[model samples]
Target chain A: MIRMRDLRKDFSVRVPAGRLRREKRLVSAVDGVSLTIEPGEMVGYIGPNGAGKSTTLKMLTGVLSPTSGEVSVFGLTPVPQRTRLALRIGVVFGQRSQLWWDLPLRESFRLLRHVYQVPPAEHEQRLRRCREMLDLDAFLDTPVRQLSLGQRMRGEITAALLHGPKVLFLDEPTIGLDVVSKQAVRSFLAELGATGAVTVVLTTHDLADIERLCDRLVVIDHGRVVHDGTIEALHARYGSRRSLVVDLDSPLPAGFVLPGTSVAGVEADGHRVTFALDETSAAAAVAGLVAVASVRDLSVVEPDIEDVVARLYRAG
Target chain B: MAETGETWAGETWAGGTRAGAIRAYAALVGGKWRSMLSYRASFAAELLSNVGATVLDVTTVFVLFRATATVGGFTLAEAILMTGLTAFGFVLADLTVGNIDDLKRYVRTGQLDTMLTRPLPVLPQLVFTDLPLRKLLRLVFGAAVYGVALAVNDVPWTAGRVLLAAVAPLGAGLFFGAIFVLTASFAFWWVESGEIGNGFTYGGRDFTSYPITVYAHWFRDLFAYALGFGFVSYQPALALLGRADPLGLPAWAGFVAPLVALPAVAVATLAWRTGIRHYRSTGS
Candidate 1:
């Protein structure tokens, strides 16, 4: 359904220097990356910030013309064939609202009907199906801004798919959502992928999003694809442990052992501690921390693929 | 064709019909109008400001005519007609590029990517989506003033003369719209387009408001042959009043509306397409 050969996108950025001088620099956002996505496959494109994940998606959707590359969506060059390719694909940008901000959700759907030229009957059917699947009818009349983030995201997803696109490209579909909203989006995507109707390409920084929704994982960094495999393979090779940073009110004893985790690191003052825990042990570790007398600040940091890539670079 | 309600099985056009495209544009406009409607106070304020600006422009011309028998050989009534025509020219230009102020925002905030992903062509969606619908009032107001000006001036009524007066500015407005398109296209390359575009869209409108004879010969030629603002009001008014062209243009130059404006629009369209072809969207 999609193919990219040696895709490269270079951006010129200006940097201010000294009092009154600026430097022009060309930064390669996507460099010599190649990819092929088949129909009915859900692939998660993961990378650290500025790691070319969004750039690749933009090229696939024909939003950006690559500096030096060959890109074909449904066998047509994406840049020249962007408009035609657009008909076959739908994209959801997580950070931005694609629906009209002030209009009701149903109004946006109606606009999409004209935009994609869906027959009215087909549009109604699609809307009914989407509303049922996403539980959208509850707030159908609400303006997009009035809805919660999760509702708005669901609205965007429905709008993107109303045209029945062959491929769905999502950039961060679950950012800034409450736990329940995140779970809803994850389940929705999983169900959508299970139906085997449309191929899905998702780019997100969140690891749990990848773990739940993706059948295949493609990791990119510094403008190149670093890993292309299954989640198990990523876990096996760079199987990461989660870190829980806890600041104690006072120094810890020399031989203290955390209940469910092993000590990962400690700051100069023994009050700062990092505990490494597996996914299942997270709740127990937090419970262990609750038992401790005094804690200043506590945060659970997810597994970061950038660090995994960096560790590999250092070892190589 | 593929079965309905199924994901496209293969490559095919998505709603490529002109009717569908027009429907999409109307929806886009309707969406923008509703968005503006949400801010009713802002819309009302903007409408009042535009009407105030028009009134002030009329007062400037009226005060000048009051002080002298004729400024640049234009009678009081002729000057008022020029005011009406110039204002209409602006209204026409704004129809296409009224919301161009949003173009810069779209670029900076990456909304352009959202637009490009749609099945519809990007240019029409961008051009028509956020048009300032409130500005249409200025045109109606201008037309009313034009009728009063023609009546007060007591110019002999002829079909050719009245037709020229109406059609000429429409063409000129298209020409100004062409400039708006050009400036938006330039934004794709330069990334800062508002100031530069204003020089043409706003500056050109201001320059053409008065009689071309009010300016020195060099300035008049620059704005006429060089920038194409002359066709907006000066040439058409001259032809309507049956006065000779003082700038050495052909006596039939007032009818050259299509000759000048159409090509300008064509060039602007070409520039816009090129800009899109090489478009490097802001940060990834």
Candidate 2:
């Protein structure tokens, strides 16, 4: 559904001095990034601050043009003919809304329907479906400005999807939502992807959002993609290290070492110990710890998505 | 479904300029108008403030005329007419282009990204987003004042003169509006310089409210040639008042007010397109 090759975006900004002197500087926001997204796939584009995730999304949505290379959305170049591409794509910026602030949610949807030239029958059908799917009927009459953050986000999702776009670009769609609201948004997005009619490119720092809604992941750092693979693949690749916390009933055997494990830290009580084991066997590490300590309590800490991405960047 | 896709693709390639632009602009204006109507008290207060400001300005001009007896070869009645008409033209421009002045805020707050993704021209979308209906009250107040001044001063108002007067204000409004658009186009490159555009728009109005000939030779020529404030108010009023041309362009120049407005709008639009290119490349 989307193809980007050798995509680069640079910004030339003027540096203001005290009175009259000024200088121009160029900062490359996105550099030589190439990506492809398949139809109906939910992909999470994750990166640290200023890692060019938003810039890449903007390029795909035709909000920003690439300094070099090509971007095609559903077989059409986004920059050469952006207005047409807009008709087929829906975008939701988490920090901002596209709805008319003082007007009711229904009015904004009606205006969009007319603007998109949706046939009346199709418009009504889509409106009903979106409202039912998003549970928006209760607040449809309320002004958008009056709606709660969650309600406003639901309204935004409905507004973006009312035209039945083939692809939805959600830039931090769940940024400020509460836990319950985030779950509600995630479930709706999941169902939308299940239908196989819309492709979603979700860019967010919320790793939980990535874990729940995205199957494939693209991790970008410093304007480059450092890792791209399925969530399972990433987990298997970097998530091999395990930490075992062992609490012994009795104190100290001095200088006792376990095979294939290094003691990470020990508690002051001298009965608790932590070990970092290589990616060999969890069973063997637990067995080795059981032989040396009483093992009053045992816990295994597995690697998470956030930790994996952090380690990947650190290694880079 | 294939046929629908084909139709959509065809419309997309054609750019959908006619119905798409019209529908988008109407929706924007309609939504904004509805929002404005929602806050009745604030709306009323805004309208009242506009009326008060208009009255104060007209009164100042009237008092000045009483002291001077005439300004730049124009009688007291003619000066009142000029002030009234210019006031009306300015109010109309404010009503239409008030939102264009707020484009800097859009750029600064990053709201321009939302506008860029829409399937419409950003300028029209920006203009339609906020209509500022409060200024309409000011327009009416200025028109009423102009009417009373013309009646009390015993200036003859024939049907042709009345028609010309009505159309002249619209042409002038368009001319000023074009200037606002051109100025707003600069926000794409120099974000902080949005206020600089205001210097030409509101500043030109404030300067031309008085007789242009009252100024020095260089200032008058600068305003005439460089800024073209004469096309907006001075020369049009010269023809309307049946006075000899001060700048001495030609007898036919006043009749081409609409033509003059067309080019200003065209140039402004060209600047806007160029600005969009800059925005796309720089992302600033």
State the lDDT at B7 in candidate 1: 33
* C-alpha lDDT score of every prediction, in listed order: 0.80, 0.79
* Candidate 2 residue-wise lDDT, A25-121, digit = tens: 8888888899888987899999888888888988998878789988999798886678788888989987768998999999999888766666666
Stretches off by above 4 angstroms in model 1 are A236-316, B1-14, B154-162
- Listed per prediction, chain B TM-scores read 0.89, 0.84
For each candidate, give its TM-score against the true structure.
0.85, 0.89
lDDT by residue for model 1 (B1-284), tens: 12322533323454479878898898888888888898999898888887787677667787777789888877777777777777776677786676665677787787888889988777788877777777767777767776676677655568888788668768767878888888877777777665887887777877777887888888878887687778778877777777777667776887664457888889998988897776776554
Candidate 1, A1-316: lDDT as tens digits: 7888999999888899888999999999999998888988999988778888888888888888899989988898887888888888889999877898888899999888888888777667667767877899899999898999999999999998887788889998988888988888888788778778778999987878887888898888889887888866765688687789888888777777876678888995888888988544777887877686488888988777557756743443
RMSD of each: 6.6, 3.9
In model 2, which runs have C-alpha deviations exceeding 4 angstroms? A14-22, A236-239, A250-270, A275-279, A284-293, B1-17, B145-167, B280-284
| Candidate 2 pairs with clashing backbones | none
Which model scores highest in TM-score? 2
